[model samples]
Target: MRILISGASVAGPVLAYWLTRHGFSVTVVERAPALRKTGGHAVDLFRPAMDISEKMDVLPRIEELATGANRMTVHPESARRPVRADLTKIFSAASDRHVEIMRDDLSEIYYDATLGDVEYVFGDSITAISPDGEVRFENAAPRRFDLVVGADGLHSNVRRLVFGEESRFSTFIGAYLGVLTLPNTAGLDRELLIHVGVGRTAGMYGAPHLGDARALFLFRSERELDYHYRDVRRQKEFLREAFAGMHADVDHWLDELDRTPAFYFDSITQLRMDTWSQGRVTLVGDAGYCPGPAVGGSTTLGVVGAYVLAGELARADGDHERAFPAYERAMAEHVRASRGVALSAAKTLIPTSRLGVSGLAQGARLVSALPAGLSRAFLRLTTKSARLYNSMTIDDYPPSPAASSGRVGLGVE
Candidate 1:
């Protein structure tokens, strides 16, 4: 089977890896000219995702690149001193196995794992898709494939072409987020500092592995802002306006926005689709069912989805007729569970008022002051949504006869 996957980020490369392992020819097309190396915040790989990574033989490398920050400091707008919490303890309590690695690092690890075996077409994009699996690309010749999958992020081009308008499937969570790289002037060493104001947050943390710092902004918006998703200048303006006069620290971060070459801005949104597959085309990860950006464990969900999608295909002998529905059935409940957590998580991260922000800061301080065991227990009890991380069970699929005999190899280049 010849499979074409759009977007070479986490889910695309992962799906490609499993498909090739199952004796299918896989080709990944990415819009970026090369592997994206920077400008993404840290992403968590909970137990299930770690298990999948181990199966892919990339866990050791992911561990090697895990973020070194062991603590998080919450700075309230009115407080003189910040409240610090131990990140290691918090995550350890959440899961027996947890790895927090930079998003770009994880992307590179997945890309490297598949680069030697799969065909990668960088600096191009799909313009259209036909009912019979014909694909048109902007910079390359049109081609036909047995199947097409969209692993692209929130605003997926493949989803737009195949599933129709994005607004139909997109759910705005009444907020916006922006992340950028900056200088480590905070002198942070394995620590993260977050400043919270009414309905807004500005954070600066060290990225020791990348030898720089990262600035993150999340602010509440009652309605979705009207702007081009791809326009960096307009996005920057929106961020500045939303966070204006909230804090001097935020102003400092915004001042450096124009100087930063790599910037990411997007609405805090979730993608909810009733069906992930239609005929020969389907969607995976954020393209199909993103709980919400940043707040939800989207990276973990994407990894699990890729594994299930490919495993189902292998189990069905590469029959989309059987595999697509099985994949949807396997992931439907998990997606629903994730969507339920998105709204509350967003509200917690970006509070709606000054009083809420203060209360959140006080709660953090109280949690930090509690005994270690007590704190962990308290966190586990309070964070009911964390269960979403391990909600889906992975079923192991035996390698097909062709795959077991090493029949799977690089397809026509």
Candidate 2:
């Protein structure tokens, strides 16, 4: 059997790793020219994703590069007072079984691990996917496959071609987010400092390696402002306008935003799909069910989803008819739980009102005073109330194969 997968970042490569192990030929196509080395968003690997990584033997290396900043300071921008909350207290509020790592580094590691076995076509994308399992690439010739999967992001071309317009499934949460790399001018040492107020929040923290700093900007917006996704100048203007006349390093952040080539901005949108599989083609990760930027479980969901997919395929052998629905059954409840957490986390963490922030601060102080074991227990219960958040158990998925399918023809444009 052969499979064609789109988007190499997280789910694509991971699915390749497992499907190849199960003796299926696999090829992955990425829009980026190479393994992406930019973007510094911090990602946490929960239990199942971590376990999958351990089985893949990449967990230790991931830990070597993991960020260790466990304390976060929530400050009132109006009063300039630091809220006394540790990192665990501020970020998770209720969970303890998470490991944080930079998104780009994780992508690089996953890509490297799959390079020897998975065929990768970079700087290309699919223009159309026919039910006959034929893939037409924008920059390549068409090729027929046994199965096709869309692991592309929110704006997925594969999904658009096969599933219909994205407008049918995407729901907009009331917010916007922008992340960019900034020079370590503040001289932070493994700490995340957040300043929140007036429906806007900005924070800068040192890179785990102390190399440079990363600035994160988030705000609640009721209206959608027009801007180009690829136009940096326009994006900078939106950032400037939203933050105009605001306190706390607005001028310096605006200057840094203009110079940073890796700036990433997007709306907090979620994907609500009733089914992830269509004919022989399927969907995984954010392409099918993004809980939005509001949810921090994207990485975890992607990793766990890949593992479950592989296991189902192995159990069902070559029959996608049985495998696809089985994969959904195994993961649907978990998806719903993870999505719920993503929907609610941002609103609570970035507290919309002064009283909310104060109550959060007081709660953190109370939690911090507990003993080690007690603190861990309290966190497990209070944070991430979702039952499926980290409750992944890798079933009997076979190991990934050593040989890849190489590049297949995508019908010419």
Q: Which candidate number maximizes lDDT?
A: 1
Q: Write the per-residue lDDT of candidate 1 for residues 1-413, one digit (tens) a residue.
A: 78999999899999999988888888999999998986788888988899999999999999999986788989888778878887776777666689888899999999999977899999999999888778899989999987899999888898898889998989898888899988777788788888888788888888567777889999888888888768888999988887887667778888999898678888888998889898888999999999888888889989999999998988887778899999999988888888877787787778888887887787676666777778767766776556667455778866788676655432323
* lDDT of model number 2: 0.76
Model 1 ranges with Cα > 4 A deviation = 405-413
The candidate that achieves the highest TM-score relative to the unseen native structure: 1
| Model 2 regions lying over 4 Å from their true place | 88-96, 385-388, 392-394, 398-413
As a whole number from 0 to 100, the lDDT of residue 327 in candidate 1 is 97
TM, every model: 0.95, 0.91
lDDT of residue 142 for candidate 2: 89
- Across 1-413, the per-residue lDDT of candidate 2 in tens digits comes to 77889999888888888776666678999998988877667777877787788888899888888877776676766665676656664334444465778888888788888877788999999998888878899898988888888999888888998889998998877778888887878777767777677667777777557387777888878877677778878877777877776665656776888678578888888889999899988899999888876355888888888878877876666578898999999888877877677766777666678876665565666676666566656666766633456455556665433223322223223
Residue pairs in candidate 1 whose N, alpha carbon or C atoms collide under 3 angstroms? none
